[model samples]
Target chain A: MLTSGIILLEGGLLNPNPGLIFWTAISFFIVMLILSKFAWGPIVSMLEEREKGIQSAIDRAHSAKDEAEAILKKNKELLARADSEADRLIREGREYADKVRTELTEKAQQESQKMIAAAKDEIEQEKRRALDVLRNEVADMAVKGAEKIIRTALDAEKQKAVVDEMIRELAASRN
Target chain B: MRVKAISRILALVVPVLLSLNSHVFAVTAQAEAPVKESATAAAPAGPATVAAPEGVAPAEATATHEAEGAEKPGEVIMHHILDNKVYPIEPFGEIHLPEIAAKPFGIDISVTKHVVMVWLACAVLLVVGLTVGASFKSLSSKESPKGMANAIEALIDFIRTDVAKSNIGHGYEKFVPFLVTVFFFILICNLIGLIPYGATATGNINVTLTLALFTFVITQAAAFKAQGVKGYLQHLTAGTHWSLWIIMVPIEIIGQFTKPFALTIRLFANMTAGHIIIYSLIFIAFILKSYVVAMAVSVPFAIFIYLLELFVAFLQAFVFTMLSALFIGLATAHEGHDDHAVEGAHH
Candidate 1:
């Protein structure tokens, strides 16, 4: 056993068997052809299909993100416009209220001045009428007194004194 | 149904028994013949003639030629590793396969152990590949691959992206089928060797050489297709001066052949050496004929080597496919593709 072992070890280790080469080549070639026909096409196409599916999914996600961003921008613009509108309305209301207040104040002042001027004219007319009536009354009283003196046949000095007293009484009664 | 089952059982067991019977018969025949020779030598009482080296060579050669006659550890290892016209199942029997002798060239075309294993590997590849294909056909492409389809898909994707696409570069799709076939075939063959009573076809020099030859042919054909006849011839000069063509041309030619040669040797040696180491380690117990020796040294180391061999099996397949793709890439590369040409080799 040892002798045969040594002999085979020396001679047979590196020896190439031609039969194996022939069979291996034939078998390998057949396998390559068979597998190429049956196996590769389906696998590669399936992989490509999956890849396309993934790529389209990514594309959809991107478009959705863009749409969301656009909506956000639009909403922000709307909010800003509404805020400014509110501010504008408040500012206009305040200005209108101020204008109304000033207009009312000016109208009240003019109306009060007109009422004062009319009352002063009415007082002045009453004072002139009173003066005319008092003057007329004095003149009538003096005529009555002078007629009484002539009927009685009184002295000159005594008649002058009585007429003075009669004038003073008439003036007092008019006041 | 009972009868059908019984018949099925018989169909499986009969061949195994028949082969076992033949192997027992052959062993007795060999034992008796060797005894007769040694007895005649002893009867002659001629120690000098028995010692002659030339007298022994024929007997040894004849013993080797007889496939069932090898008994030594070295002989057993060689018989297992080399191609033979039988499938040996120790203690049972061996199946005597047919041998075809080519007329003019005188080549032996025997469906040996390696041949049978190659066929088995092919059958496996066919079933697995086709099963995956069928699943892909039946199931929707959007669905994730399941069961065998899932595993097959991973292997396919790996070889496509890492091996074929990375190495072959642009227009790599065309070569994916071939590369995928090569990778799976070699991987399955390597794994088949790990089975009991199975042979590693890739461990055989001829088998490795044949695989490398395929790569060689493909590479050269691709080069021819890309560079044309004139450009292909021009590459042999390697862009050297006319004065240096005499030196550079042969070197370039050798370089082309050397890549494949190296590939063949690399795979063959890696596979063969792992088995040899494991076998040698286990043989230590037999040599000492001691249980302690086996338990303490041989069995543990052998087991360790066997595990290492399993890893090596995958690695060698990967390296071979990687190198083949790199070589194909180098050959098919155009002017602008030169940058990635070296990248393939490095990996």
Candidate 2:
């Protein structure tokens, strides 16, 4: 066995073959051609399509994100505008209510003052009428009482002179 | 009287010559007797007739002849370069490897070890192809790929779409497989060659030539298919002046042959040169017979070259595929006016 092994080693070293080159080339070409036809075509194209698809999807996602962000920003802006508007309306309403309240108070005070002035004037007129009527009645009653007493007490000229003299004396005393 | 005296002297000389011949025969008979006895008898012994020169031993002469026979150093170099050996049993005797036998087909052959390696390479390619195919089959709706499948797909797609379709426009689908296969096969072969004790089929000139020949055949067929025979011949003329046909035809013909030749040489030289550099660097250890020097100098240099070879393997495959696509593109290009709008539009 050892002798045979030595012989084989020696034979290999002594006679190195070159023909492997030709056969290997043939086989390689055959394999490459067949595989290229069957396997490589689909694999490569599929991969390329996949790459392109992935790239496009990424682009689409990015654009969608940008659009969503823009929309969000617009919504935020709109929300801020609405808030400002609401604040503005509230401020205007408060100012309007304040103005209305001030005007109503001024009107109420003016109406009250007019009513008090009218009542005072009516009271004064009524008091004046009552005083005038009372004065007239007192004057009439005094004259009638004086006439009756004079008629009964004296006759003719003597009576007249005495009455006149008494009347003059009373008038002077009353005065 | 003088003639008679001469005759008498001749007679005396002839008798003496005859007597001397008999004496010589007797001496020869005495020498032959021992040799004849030794020839007849099993145990008969005699001194061997073959004589060695004085002062030099027989074994020493044989040693000298052996030293002379070993003088051809080129044979030793070639043996190391080309020889593939299978060590049937390990030095420790713990493992036994199958004996490698060469199977010859006609004058040519695949060595058992190389055949096994090649078959192994092919099997690897098959698995890779099937794996990639299966991944594609089971691909999800999600766009992204992960892991080895992703990597393989990326490489395959780069070759098919980027290299093949982008270069060879129009009927690129038909050629994608060819281009991809070549790229991967060569890539695999080159990588395998980098392995210890692996034979590089692509490194051989004949291998490269056969590959180039396939390209040549394909290119010619594509041209013929794209343009009829007359148109194809006219393509060779290239719408030049009728008077210039003589010069143009030969030049074009030469160009045709040169393309494939260049392809063959480029692949063969590129692949072989890397291996040669690596082998030569590693061989320094054996040539110098110093482990320390080899470790310090050759190992580092060899490693550097090896890394370069790795890059080269990929590059060579890419270049070969690219050039093939370019050639196919050129062959199938429309005759006469150069309107590359079709190609430009695809890109």
Candidate 3:
């Protein structure tokens, strides 16, 4: 049993086995080929794709945030512009209202002055007509007084007292 | 359901029984092993053979001579460590792997213990690779991979980032598949060796040597592709003076071969040594014929080392993969990177 052949066979932990080596080479290459096709290739690309997806998503988020900020800024500017426009319109409307009010007041003052002038002219015409009527009444009274004096002759002192009494009666009648 | 269960039970039991059968082979192998007279002569039989020198006991211990009580536990240890043609089981018959002859190559391509284990390792890799690949395919770009697929992906990423990319640099993508496959294959083989009735194919020189040879060829090819033939010769000269060519060329060439050589020996010795230590520890109990030693020292120490072997399995695989990538990186590196090319090698 201790034949040199068994020792040679058993002594082979160090020695090369061409058969095993051949199989090792074949199997290893086969494994590398199969795994390259079915395993490593797909996994690596997938992981890389995932990384890219994450990165792009981050970039998209950043851009979206910037866009939102830009829109907000534009809206704020628009709000400020609209506020100024409203203030300008309100100020112009007030100015126009004040102008219209002052112009209307001046026109009212001119119209009232014309109306007062017409009233004063009418009053003057009425006063002049009344004086004419009074003057005619006074002339009629003086004729009647002279007729009475012709009917009755009086002395100089009596004529003078009669004239005074006639004047008093005329004044009372005129009042 | 019952039949399916029964088949499942058979699936588990068969390999275990088959492995136990090797012990029956061990008994017969003990009888057929070297005699006491030739023990010293056949002492240095295997490469890096340890534990046998201490076992100067006779092969035939049946005579009950006080000397015969000192039996050849070394023979038993060798029987366990060495590759065999039969997949021996105790109660059931052994499965004999067929041997084919290639007359042109002068090679015997037989299915030995290590070969079957290598195939088993390949099979394991297939299931794992396919599973991880399937998960990657099924997962949406947004969704993270889960379970064993995720674990395997982490390892793959580690190899890609730490092993291939960091070591090989720019053209690293091309070598990822090769490095990843080698890492998992070697890891599976190392772990399978730790299993009961399992053989470490990496423990075999032919296996590691063939693997190292693959690395060597790829490295050379990459160098040729990257540097061209003139550059390759220049790389062999190591940018030294023409006067130093005699000293530098041979050393540089040897250095090229020695990297793979070291890789082969490092893995082979580590895997084989762990087993040898465990077996040697157990055999010490037998050699002393003491139950106290078996319980207190032998079993405990063996168990401890076995646990350590589990860690070593992963470590050795990582080392082999890391070294392979580093070598490829070193070889394919450009002319400007003469100094910093092997910076990763220090790690």
Candidate 4:
């Protein structure tokens, strides 16, 4: 115990030496000042610069991604619009074809009706001419027969009446 | 796997070798003690504290012999932990520092082994700092950090971002340089002790106290800046009843001083204790005076303690830096914290 006490007393290890403290304080301050100014200043700025570069790079990438996404959306929208437009055009084309076919059929029926009317008219005219010729012939025959019998020509009214009568008689017999 | 095996082998072999070596060392030391004492006695004009007295050497020698006989292992351990004027530079002779001003103002102003180690630590910091700073300057932006610059950058980034910025808040940038200096300086000083013939400067109470003093001053200055005179005084009141001001105020004031006191004691005790533990473990072989006990037990235990000391060195340095930042953070913190405290009190 005594020896230990003496060692503790003699050993100034626990005791704070002012000169050592002074030297330590001086050296620490010197290190802090020199390092803070020269070493730390530039290194920190460089780190900041690197961080800034990384941030800008990330920002650029984000913008590029946004732009690409926007373009993709636009392309999809255009595709959808084109798809709708094609559908409308196809429907319109089918409607137009149906309208054209209906109009052609109606016009063809009217044209055929008109042609039939003209043909009937043309037949009526030919019939009338033939009747006139037949009436004249019959009247001549009747006149000839009568002239053979009486040796005289008949009047125009009397001949017409006779022709009408003969014609009516012929139509009734054919029926 | 290989390293573990080798260490296991060392764990078995080293104690016996160490015990044998120390026994041989004890004999030489016994013989040499008289010669060193006679030399010191011859040089009587030497600064009293600078050259350790002849009278002390014989006592220490005999004390070691007693420790070998298991009479005073604790003293032997204490001697290893404490600072000395002479540094044993392993495989080479001792470096006896000159004592400058033996007792000016009733203080021992002798340069010690730890002081020389501190200077060496500072010199190393200067060289590395300059080299790293130069590398940062010369290297182009495109090139990544290489060699020492890379290693330094990692340390800088950790202290700046993790320690300083996280603790000190918004204006943390200003304190980064000082924090980095403190961290690396303490770390290097701690590491120096683990080397052969090297001393742990941070182990000394004087050195640690001086360092803590810087932190204390910086912290208080920050508090003063943030709080101003009125707010700073109000902070000391601890937001208690005026009746309790008598009790609370003094405690709050002591609290300020205790933070730095804690910092000093923590670092000093940690460094000293690690050394003492390692010495004690190694001394166990000397205490036993048995090769079997040395090989099987003390040597392996000492190696393990030595490795632990290595880890403690880094941990203690980091803790000191981190706590300093934390204290600075507390000092400069905003006033909203008080409102939160008031709200908590209502509950």
Candidate 5:
């Protein structure tokens, strides 16, 4: 164990090998040159690019959500206005219908009363004509009967002349 | 689900063990290997009974007199844990590496097994990195990666966010490439060691120290840039009184290096130590020369440590990267940052 440290320190494993060192340095330098330029450069930038893309996508989603909300609010307001407009039009139509019904009922009642009055006046004129015709016929019949009686009575002439003169005097006095 | 996981692990482990057992039997049949095995066979007997001073004498005695085909557990353990000039191949035995004795500035730049392993790790890093990069090119910003690409992305992502950004704070982008490369490279190297007959580059102190050296250099440079020359030099005094500058400056300088020193030792020791432990456990059976111990004690315990080593592989990689980023963060952090506020609140 004691000699082991001495062995390492003096001449064995710890002995300087310049050849190995030379190879290590050259190889390391070359490896460092190629790997740095090629491998790590592209990978890092790709990661960053992906991150930026994700951020922009999130921003777009937020903006689209806000726009959709605004459209929904505008649609609700238009729906409410249409509802109130429909209600007003229905009330105006009901009032116009009631006014037309009252005017038609009053005009029908006035036309029926004028027709009844015209019929009554025509009936009164017809009654007067019939009475006049009856009266003329009766007067003609009485005159015919009186003429027959005078012809019979004139056969007893003398006695009849004296009666006629008295009758004429009575008629003149009555007039 | 538990049975299925265990079966999955068994399915991975069984083939490896069978292949390794077959290779060991094949290696024993080779010509030159048996003699070398006999030469160093006496070493394992030393660890239990003999003193460290006499550890070398028995091996020398065994090779000369007792030329039996015996294996030294210590030598085998160290050989597996340490760097060498040969890469062991499966079924064929092994290949002798080319030793380039190029002493540039009087230091041998010879290629070793660990060097080949480092190259292997770099090759792996390149394939994975370039594949991921190409996939990213085809992928739209909206699309995510799949399968292996996805797994690799998770690791790279962890390093960037958790290791680099949380530690280094501002201006962390500049260091992400370096930190990620270090993490993946160290992780691959550590895991490679876990594979049967594979050498761990991170297990070598030389390799770990070199990585730490890079961290050290970056930390100082960042400190210099973030705090100007005046501030950088002033930091060496550690905000101490003028009377304590002599003691404080040396300490502060040493403190600056200690961070990387810790990182180097942490990774190297952890990787090397786990392999040492596993080999030591397996060698217990060979040391005792018994089948019952091999079955009941050695194999089971070794497997447990092997699993633990897998976790440590990822951990050490994370620790190294974390410390590196922390040092950089400490160097670049402003005076009135949350660090000072927390410190103030503590006081």
Candidate 6:
């Protein structure tokens, strides 16, 4: 057994001896087979699983980034729309206030004009009534004064006839 | 006028003639000595001795001699192929193992110089595997990868997903480590070969042949395991006439051996060819004896080839792994039911 072991050792695969090729082939086959059985399958699956995990992670990251970008875009759009809407509302409010102010100013001016015209009409009516009253009173006084004068004038006529007789006599005498 | 002319001519001619003659004699003497020495050297070395090939000038001979003295071409080639001086040579001489004799049913194991490199390579693989395995173990959560583990993990995953699982299919998980190790080991060996003074184990036909043979055996074993002995034999006669079995069987067996042989040659040739081209180009500089031209040409050319060699190293590794996987895939494929058809027809 020792001699055989020596022979095999002296002529082993480790050395550049004869049968080295054969032994190397056998040893390689055994090692490959054993490793395949014991270690390979698990290691490979683990590696594959890790790779798949990484790829999926990358895919997930890309999707998340896209989603974030989309959300950002949407937010920007909403902000722009809101800004436009606020601007429109501000313009509308200003126009509405301006319209109300113009209408109010016009209504106030119309009401003031109507009030002024009514006051002028009242003043004219009062003037006409005062004139009518003064005219009636003056006519009555004038009529009364005329009657008295006529009566007085009849008396004077009588006296005058008497005096005329006298004067006629006197003048006849002077002539 | 004649006397004045003759003196002027003499004054101009004397120095020019002397210098020209001196330059000519100097060049001639220098050229003659090497020829004379070679002639003397050749006389005693005998007629059967190969003359230095013609057109090689004395300058070329001297340059070649200097180059030979500095580093022989054979030594350079050998150093590129098989030199392994990673660590400084240790002086702690041989220590024979007493444990080999003590075992009752012993296995004799001895360490040699090459064996030591092989052992070192194995140790490196073991250390790397264990370290990676430990890192894998320490992964508490899968949220994000960290450190060297991430890089190693990525490589392992690529090999598994792309090479092994893709080819080997259902039972591919079993062969991943073997495939990965083979790929990495061959890749490292090829890369090391490209480095100055580093050995390429895979560049050796013997080493590659051994690896290929291993693949061949695994393929056969897998085929046999998948289908029984009878089924395995019937697989060779797949899709064939009954009378064609003799011709087909030998061809099939030969096909098996040829795959590994091709693997050996492909790797060996690819690795050796690039090195030879680079060495030959550099050798031109010495052959020409013109340092200016050599520096201008050879250095750039060699550098380009070296870069190409780096790419080849990875390519060869990938090709070997891919082909090996393909072979394994073919071998483990389902056995055809052609034998049943033949049997039914006979009945």
lDDT of 4 by residue, A28-92 (tens): 99988998877888898888888889999999999999999999999999999999999999999
Best by lDDT: 3
Q: TM per model?
A: 0.73, 0.56, 0.65, 0.77, 0.66, 0.52
lDDT, model 6: 0.58
* Residue A82 of model 1, lDDT score: 100
DockQ of each two-chain model: 0.32, 0.13, 0.27, 0.37, 0.25, 0.06
lDDT of 3 by residue, B231-326 (tens): 999998889899999998998888888888888877887777777677767766755558999999989988987887888899889999999898
lDDT of 1 by residue, B246-291 (tens): 9988877888898889888778777776776666666556544589
After superposition, the stretches of candidate 3 with alpha carbons farther than 4 Å from their true spots are: A1-10, A58-175, B1-71, B90-93, B101-104, B336-347
Best by TM-score: 4
DockQ of 3: 0.27
Model 1 chain A — which ten-residue stretch has the worst lDDT?
A1-10
Model 4, range B1-347, lDDT digits (tens) per residue? 24333444443344344445555565655545564555434422212233233475774865643333322344444445566676655344556789876575676777777778889999999999989999999977778999999999999999989999998897988888888999999999999989876778898898999999999999989989988988888788877789999998898798788888888987886777667656656666665557988898878987887897787777778888988898888788865445224323322
Docking class of 2: incorrect
What fraction of the true interface does each of the listed models get right, in terms of native contacts kept? 0.68, 0.35, 0.67, 0.61, 0.64, 0.13
| Higher-ranked by DockQ: 3 or 4 | 4
Model 3 TM-score relative to the real fold? 0.65
Best by DockQ: 4
Q: What is the TM-score of chain B in candidate 2?
A: 0.69
Tens digit of per-residue lDDT, candidate 6, span B1-347 = 24323433432342233334333433444555465455434322211112233455887876544332233232333333332212222233223322223322343333222333334444455555556566555554454456765665676677777877786677876567667777766676677666643555565555677778768877889889877798778777665797998898787677667777777766765766566556655755644447876888778878877887788788777777877776777677784444334323322
Query: Once model 3 is optimally superposed onto the true structure by TM-score, how far is the C-alpha of residue B334 displaced, in angstroms?
Result: 0.7
Clashes of 5: 0
Model 5: which docking level applies? Answer: acceptable
How high a TM-score does candidate 5 get? Answer: 0.66
lDDT minimum window of 10 residues, candidate 4 chain B: B43-52
